[model samples]
Target chain A: MNAIVTVLRKEVRDTLRDRRAVLSSLAGALFGPALFAVFMNFTVERTIDEGEAAIEIPVVNAADAPNLVGYLGQHLIEAKEAAFDSREELRASVRRGETEVGLVIDKQFGTALGEGKAARVWIVADRANASAQTAVARVRGALRSYSSLVGVLRLQLRGVDPGVARPLAILNDDVSTPSGRSVLLLGAFTYFLLFACFLGGLHVAVDSTAGERERGSLEPLLTLPVSRGALVAGKFAATAFFMAVALIIGIAAFAVAVDYLPLAEVSMDADLGLVECAMAFAVLVPIAVLGAGLLNAVTAFTKSFKEAQSYSGIAMLLPTLPILLIILNPMQPTISMMLVPSLSQHLLITSIVKAESIDPLYFAVSATSTVAIGALFGLLAVWRYRSEKLLV
Target chain B: MIEAEGLTKRFGDVVAMDDVSFRADDGRVTGLVGPNGAGKSTTLRVLCTVIKADSGRARVDGVDVAARPLDVRRQIGALPHLSGLYPNLSARENIAYYAEMQGMPRREAGRATRTVIDRLGIGDLSDRRAKGFSHGQSIRVALARALVHRPQTVILDEPTNGLDVVATRALRDVILDLRRDGRCVLFSSHVMQEVAMLCDELLIISEGRVAISGTPDEILRETGCGDLEDAFVAAISSERESK
Candidate 1:
């Protein structure tokens, strides 16, 4: 135990003095939060701006339907006189993306309305253009309302009640809360936190194993009167320490970055506060042990520092796989899912951000399972160290 | 003291050490002189507990290397073929790290580190990080690190592989000092002149086997050679012809 502590202290002190390692860890921790802030801010601002802005549609024959155009104007749909003379031209313009949607009134529209016959109108739009769908919907809605108003007036003229014309009323009920709406975006927050934790220990893990061997220190180091298990344990502990630090920093940075996001503008509440951050840190921190263990185990197989670095780069991506799968096909938290390390932490973090009550049983299972697997990897590293092949 | 009897280690089909036997005693410098690829390093590695011999008994101060490697490691200090130091750590810290690993208390390790640094005459270079150290400076720091624990036996593999005239002389003085202090010093060298100058007992190895081992004069007289260098060639050639 004393030997373990000695090796741990030496490794940690040596890593701290390495400027490149320290800087890389710091950079990784900050990179995720800064990117999340910028992306969230852009998305929130665009959604809010698009919600309030008026939509414009070019009308092929605006003069023929002054009254109809006037009604659309009241619904925040502006009608501009189009340069084109025919409906074909309007269709081409909409298809070319020069206009989101175009209005084309039939040549016989005025006569048909005078004779009390049905009049024709066309809304030219490309349904596949996602950005243009909003304008198309707005224009279609205004036209329908105008048609209903005229029909209601016609019913009154005939001394029939307007209510008799409509037999059904439809309403929409949405159940998602403000915080619940933000959980999808905050899922990324947990991913970044986990990634930062892994990154924090990468240098130390590679340095202690492959770097030590490459520098010719492993032989001398193994010659010391300490058990290989104790040495591995010490190195593992130091790596875990750095990872935990990075996790803390990531949680704090995300907490601050969340405040700058305009989630409220989109009716989404970012519940990432001091308490939530603390909870998240607690939930995600155990994976650092797993991260350190895994990294050390993988790098131990490499022959040189450069080879270990490249191999570890790929190894670090393992944690993110479960997160990506969960995001694409979300599942409710279950006992079996808690058995998986990164997936369990992700579910817990998502629940925390959504402001849901966490089950202590789930936390216990998740934390215990994660640490158990981490210890297994730690033991694997020790086994590798004990092998004579390690010196080769 | 270090002893190996009928030690043999093989890497797959290539035998690295074959029936190698020798004794390095306290209060004397024993040189394992061989050309590159000979078993000098392999023998040292086995004694230092870095690797195990396949088919023989090796002991450091009568502690079996295979049965009790940790105990054997405690009895010896080794400088490997490469002067491996943590580039980011100062020379003092490097030495102290080894001292602590040897089970010294923190304060005692620090004191021991200081003593070794001063004794090696490397106090001026102790505080500097090892990244910028020249080969000579690195060797001195590595030597200090190895001696910080003051084990009964010290094993160095090619300690003077690359050193200037001044550095080599300084290293010779340190080796002599270890002998005077009654510590067993076992070092390997490929250079015949270096082995002739420093070795109180010499073991000549060729092709993974001991060709001849004795005092310089004894080897010269036995081989009917006028000097140690010619005796080394004659012993190696005779061993090869017999094989």
Candidate 2:
């Protein structure tokens, strides 16, 4: 449509108008990927060096927990120990970025075990750092083994057989899918893409309608003999094109980031090629349609420039839902559940990372559903244009 | 020419326009004057095809507005109390956009845009952004956009809501020129004096219904006012007193 081209031009022109929009979008998308590359590269080398050396970690002292401290030094050729007075003080240290971790033992540890009860210790550290958390798990494992050994020695000292005391010893092994090894990787990439979509189309839609309203130029456009449908189509098409451009930048960010995920101990395939990259972009088309259509609909119904932005806040939240959900839980990707907006693309992306074959039917349905929803919203927006109350 | 029969618009049980009807002839500026919340903009928007009436038959040049909005739209132009330029685009781009929207060819839009830019005396600033322009400049741009397609009728909803004398007079001249070209022009304004000075015919609306419709001379003689503004105040008060 001629209107669609005009709308597209307006959308593109608006993007070219703002410097901050481009920088901010690329920042959200690029920060994670670029950071991941630098982090993984630095961490991998540092971890390899640490893997070859005996490392020192601080332990908070609690009275009568001698055996627990001894257990942590077993696998090392050398041990250098530091002391903290209290667990809370150690947590404060971690919070203040003074140390990566602080190991703490409770005061009641020996007393509880003497009375044959469970005793616990805390690993105080910044949860945001994955390396610190992994190290804390290793420290916990060493302490647990030491505690059980002491319990068995105590049972033998009381003249009961150690074998009889250990009758119900349980061993836990993790059973999880190899296909979803990079679920968090998928989420991180998805968040980047959502950020891309938002920043990409945002300027275009705002400038096209609300910007027009704010500057008092909406009258001339509406007064012309063109149908409101044509006007909306023009705006919607334009906004979507910009969204797609942002998406491309986002996908590039993901590609860059995924190249550097440690994928540690998972044997996950590092096999994403150019074809898969192109397919990932293709799946984004429907979402592009939805973003553009929804933006126009919100901006048009708003009375002023400020009001339109408040309405578009709903847009800012919608794309991030899938990302937030996956990041919180370990998600199993399925093709059948494609109705969840950005999650569908997330599934396809995990497949790319693990080198699993992507289902063609699933991607086809995903693009279809996104475009269909876009069309539904487009019709609602067009109906609003005919509304007397809305324009005035 | 424009005609309406039993035009009524309702929001819930409250009727804004209840069985109101009036007609206006071609080649003159017909003023629709009322205070705020008087349904003046509503009438103009309905005529511009920006909105629809709940129940009524309204037509521009015998084209049913509801039934053939696109057809009726092709015949009418309006500036509804606001400028409608795309902010990012230059003034020429904004005008060219509307002209294109009206199905004008590129060369035709170019010619018309240049002519209106010259005629409205905004030629020097046609390449500037509309967003940062002065109110008067924006109004001139809006008027240029409206007249660029040369439609058969023009309806403006309070076009002079915010303008200085220079812009207001320029708008009045543009309306007069439209009348001289034999195109029917309808505009609503709260400033009764400007309406009285510029409009040859008048429609006084109160509570969405046309309370009085006549020429400026006829309304003045009928209401016994020295001018059209006093005639409007008298007619509006008279309509309220009767109710």
Candidate 3:
């Protein structure tokens, strides 16, 4: 244990002196949170701005749809005359994002409405365009209200009760809280957090192991009186320490950055506070250890700095696997999911974000199992260090 | 004292060391002389307990290397074929790390580091990062690390392989100082004049076997050679002919 501390200090000192390693580690910590903030701010702000803006519907023949335009105007949708040389030109305008939707009323539309017959109006817009789709919905809604009113008036004129036209009234009750609805975003957030933990120690672990080998230092180091297990443990401690620090920094940055995000505009009530950050740090401890151990174990097999770097590059993608699985096959958390290390941490972090009180038993199982697996990898690293092939 | 008996090591089909055995007594400098690929490095590595021999028993201060390798390591300070220094750390830090690895407390390691730095006359270079160190400076740091623990036996592989005359003389003086302090010093060199100048005893290895082992004068008389170089060639050539 004393030897482990010694080695840890030495590893830290050596790696910290490397400016590239220091700068890269710091960048890893800041990457996830800074990106999340930018995405959230842009999306939430755009959604809010788009929601408050008036819906613009461009009609080719404004005279033919006077009543319909008036009805749409009453519904706060702006009905405007559209100018185009041809039908294709109008369609091109909508596709070019110059107009949200275009309306083309038949020449006989007034004749049809006067005779109490069907009227044909085509709503032209790209369904794939988000703003166009929303504008099309608003236009359809206004048309439906106008159509319903006309039907009521026609029924009264026929000396029948208009209420008899609809015998049933339907309503929907939605009970999902904003927190409950933002689970996907929170899951993604947790994924990046765990990823940061894995990457924080990557360079250091590779530097201390394979980098040492490439520099011709491992042989002398191994020849010391220290036990291979102790040496590995020491390296693991340094890696985990740096990883935890990096993870904490990432969480703090995320928390601070999230404060300026307009999540309330989008009705997402996620506020990553101090308590949440602390919980994230606590839950991620085992994964950080596991990540460090895994990196060390893999890099110890590599013969050079470049080989170790490529290997660790592959390892960085491992944390995201469980998150991807969760997305592809979404499932409610069971006790069994908590037994898998990264998966369990993901589930726990997601639950934390949802403001749901997790089962202590689940947290215990997750923490203990993850740490146990990490310790197993640490032992494997020790075994690798002990091998004679390590010297070669 | 350090001893190896019937030590054999192989890499695939090639034998690195074949039944090599020798002893270096305390208070004397034992020079391991060999041509290239004579297994001097392999033998030192096995003795350092970094690489295991296929079949043999090696000991430092009577502790078996294979069975009690940690104990053997504790008794020996080994400078392997590589000058393994952390380029980012200062010389003092590199040496101090080894002292701490040997189980010394931080303060004690610091003290020992100071003593080793002073003894090596590397005070000017000790605080600078090893990346910019000259070859002699780097070797001095590695040597400081090896001797920081003050082990019972010192083992070095080609300690003077690339050193200039001044650095070589300094290294020889350190070896003599170790002998004066009653420590067993075992080092390998291909330079015949170096071996002739410093070795109280010599082990000339050829084809992974000890071609001859005795004092330099004794080997010269035995081969009826002009000097240590002729004796070394005669010894290895005779061993090669017999094989």
Off by over 4 Å in 2: A19-24, A31-46, A56-76, A79-186, A206-220, A257-273, A297-304, A319-335
Best by lDDT: 1
What is the per-residue lDDT of model 2 for residues A127-178, given as tens digits with 9 covering 90 to 100?
8876676566666666667777877888888899988867787888755455
lDDT of each: 0.91, 0.75, 0.87
Candidate 3 docking DockQ: 0.87
Write model 3 residue lDDT over B79-181, tens digit each, in one string.
8777989999999999999999998999999999999999989999988999999888888889999999999899999999799999989999999999999
Question: Please, what are the lDDT tens digits per residue for candidate 2 over residues B32-76?
Answer: 888787788777767776667888889999999888888887888
Off by over 4 Å in 1: A113-118, A159-165
DockQ of candidate 1 relative to the true structure: 0.90
TM-score of 3: 0.96
Cα displacement (angstroms), candidate 3, residue A355, comes to 0.7
User: What is the Cα-based TM-score of model 1?
Assistant: 0.97
CAPRI quality level assigned to candidate 1 from its DockQ score = high
Model 3 chain B poorest 10 in a row by lDDT = B73-82
RMSD of 1: 1.7
Score candidate 2 by TM-score against the native: 0.78
Q: Report the lDDT of model 1 for residue A370.
A: 95
Least accurate 10 contiguous residues by lDDT in model 1 chain A: A48-57
